[model samples]
Target chain A: MNLILAPVRGLGRATLAVVSAVGRGAMLSVDAGRSLRRVDQWGPHLVPQMISIGVASIPLALFIAAFTGIVLAIQASYTFVGTVPLYFVGALVGKTMILELGPALTGLALSGRVGASNASEIATMRVTEQIDALESLAYDPIAYLVVPRVIAGTLMFPVVIALAIAMGIVAGWLTSIALLDLATPQFVRGLRLFFDTYDVQFAMFKSATFGTTVTSVGAFFGYTCTGGARGVGRATTRTVVVSSMIILVLDAFWAATLL
Target chain B: MSIELKDVHKAFGEKRVLRGFTLSVERGETVSVIGGSGQGKSTLLKHVNGLLKPDAGEVWVDGQRIDQLEGEPLYETRRKVGYVFQFAALFDSMTIAENVAMGLRRIPGLSEADIADRVRTALARVDLEGVDEQYPSELSGGMRKRAGLARAIALEPAYLLYDEPTTGLDPVTLSMVDELILRMSDRLGVTSVVITHDMESAYRISDRIVMLHEGRARVAGTPDEIRDSADPVVRAFVEGRADLLEEAS
Candidate 1:
């Protein structure tokens, strides 16, 4: 009986913990939404945050997308060698990059970069009493700290994902032309064969949702973090894992509903 | 009275920190709250500035009950107050000048030039001149605390709350900080409430000293009154004797 109850109790505790976390996240979202009215406070910090969260993330996003594009093209050729036309590689690369890998992978990367940093920065501020000081000074901590990052992340994730999508396709194209004995005309024809504007639209929508999730999750974890330096470390780790998980989950949700 | 905590009660989850604690301070009065590490000395100070609201009872600032206030009302009250943290709590990303200028922006009609002047003047008051360009990380602990002070007093708030203000300072810096606290009270006439375990600094800077034990003010009076108090808990805290508290715990 004890052995059976052990797992049951553990499951109950875990469920409660997740529920608490989600409840806390909801509260933070409401606070963040209300704080949106204080654009005057958060607005001035917007450009700087965009430069930091989005602009600074370019090299890493491009690097991942380029590699992914290269791999997708190679794999498509390997799988479709004898039975199917090789030009299908271009279609595969374009569709996959724009519809799936483009937003999802870039989002995961941003979750690691932007999300982790956001959580750690806010957690450090919380632990060091800086957040309290802001409150004591009558400045809205949510407006000053969380709002700019959330807005920047929401607006810039799509931009970065768009760039990544373009880079990925370009990389795949280059790989196909250089090594796969495929001509530019054949690849472009394959890409245009199945092209639909909705794929890009879907990617844009998914990336924006991913961006909001990643940054808001980061800020929420940071704001609620306790303990001390160890807590900061935990918040950063949690931000990366949770946001990445949420991005993948959202990706599937979008694919199922929209596709 | 300008600041009053009427039977304030606060608890963090399961642990009660302040229970039925009450106190009041008139304008221009400098009060120091002293106690063991976790007796809510800092908690009490935080309530005065609306940094933390009470679980029960009332927090009155000037003429208004602030415990339940939020948004613009709370901010308006906080604008008239300054709080210096134990760790300085300066923004790591900003230079000392920027940190000091943060609160000054809300002051009406203050241009960049005027704000800069105020920053310089505040830094000068804290003897932190020429360090404006430096980040908080670049400064020593003592310097960081003073820079924090500069940030707070730059606005010249009506009330100042200092939480362990002189904790990590050297003797020289400690004395300088004590002097600055006195100057804020005497020269600027800033009503100040300080939380510290340093009894000498408390006796020197505060017109009244309140000692908290368990969850409430165990004793409150002038420094001489506290020094001569016969209550065991107050005696133990006032003398900085932890062994006396060990038996109670």
Candidate 2:
């Protein structure tokens, strides 16, 4: 009786925590949505945040996309030996990079970089009473802090994804030429044969959704943080974990619905 | 503006912080709330500006019930109140000028020139000069506190709330802060509420002192009256008698 009851209690606590987090996240989103109407306040912070969240992320995204593209080309070529046309490797690499790898990997990587940093920054503000100070001064902290970050993430995510996709394709083409012994024209021709412009649109949509999730989740955890340094650490870790999970879940949902 | 809290009760999780706590401060008055750790002194100060709503009872600022206010209404109330946090809580990323200008910029129809002039004037009022471009981290502890004071004074608020204004300050800085608090109250004619454990500083700066014990106001009177109180708890606190507190408990 004790054994069964113990596991049941644990499961119940976990479910309650997840549910509580979701409710809190929804409330924060509503508050942020209201704050979004005050563009006069948050507009100045947007460009600076974009540079921080989007421009600073380019090198990491490009580096990851390049390696991912090369690996995908090598693996696809190996698997397609004699079973299908060798040029089909280009089609596989292009589709996979644009539709899946580009947005998914970049989102996951940035969940660690951008999302964790945002959580830590806001958590520090919470612990230090800067949020209270903001409120005391008659400034809405969500408008001044969270909304700018969320807007930057949402707007710049697609730009990062586009850059990542382009880098991924270029890396794959280079790999196919040098390592896979495929001609450049053959690879380019294969890429054009079955490419759909809709795939790029689909990737952008998925990335924008991921961007919102990463930032809003980070801000929610950070704003609600209590205790002190230990709490900030927990919020940062939770931001990465939750943001990455949401990105993957959204990735699957987009693929299922759009494809 | 006058500030009042009537029968306020607040709790965090299972621990109660304030239970039936009440106090009042008239306009242009300086009241210092003194209590041991975790006695809800800071919580009481926060309620005045609608930073924390009571779990029960009422909060009134200038005859207006503020506990039910939200959004812009609450902001309007807050704009008239300046809260200085224990650690100053200045934005570390911003320079001193920017920190002081933050509240000034929020007011409607304030030109850039006006904001800059106010920032300079506020800094001068706090006796901090030639440090506009420095960050909060670069300032000494006393300078940081003065900078925080400048940030609050820049708004020219009607009421000022200080949460442990003298905490962690050296003796010189502590007295400097106490003097600043008193001077600001007189010069600006702003009602001031200060939360502190330093009984001496409280007695020095406040026109009246409220002693909180176990989440409720134990006594309220002039500093002399409180110092000469018959209540054992008040006596224990005023004289730093730990044994009396132990007996009361």
Q: Interface RMSD (Å), each candidate?
A: 0.8, 0.7
Candidate 2 per-residue C-alpha lDDT over A1-259 given as tens digits, one digit per residue, 9 for 90 to 100: 9998999999999999989988988899899989988787789999999999999999999999999999988998999989978888789889999999999999999999899999999999999989998888888999999999998999999999899999999999999999998999989887987899999999998899988888888899999999899999999999999999889888888889889
TM-score per model over all chains = 0.98, 0.98
User: What does candidate 1's lDDT look like per residue over B68-184, in tens digits?
Assistant: 888888888888998898899999999999999988887668899999999999999999999989999999999999999998999899999899999988999999999999999
Clashing residue pairs in candidate 1 (N, C-alpha, C atoms within 3 angstroms): none
Q: Please give the range of 10 consecutive residues that has the lowest summed lDDT in model 2 chain A.
A: A33-42
* Candidate 2: pairs in clash: none
Q: Which residue ranges in model 2 land beyond 4 Å of their true spot?
A: A1-4
The recovered share of true contacts, given per candidate in order, is 0.81, 0.86
* Candidate 1 C-alpha lDDT tens digits along A196-218: 99998899999999989999999
Q: Give per-residue lDDT, candidate 2, residue A65.
A: 99
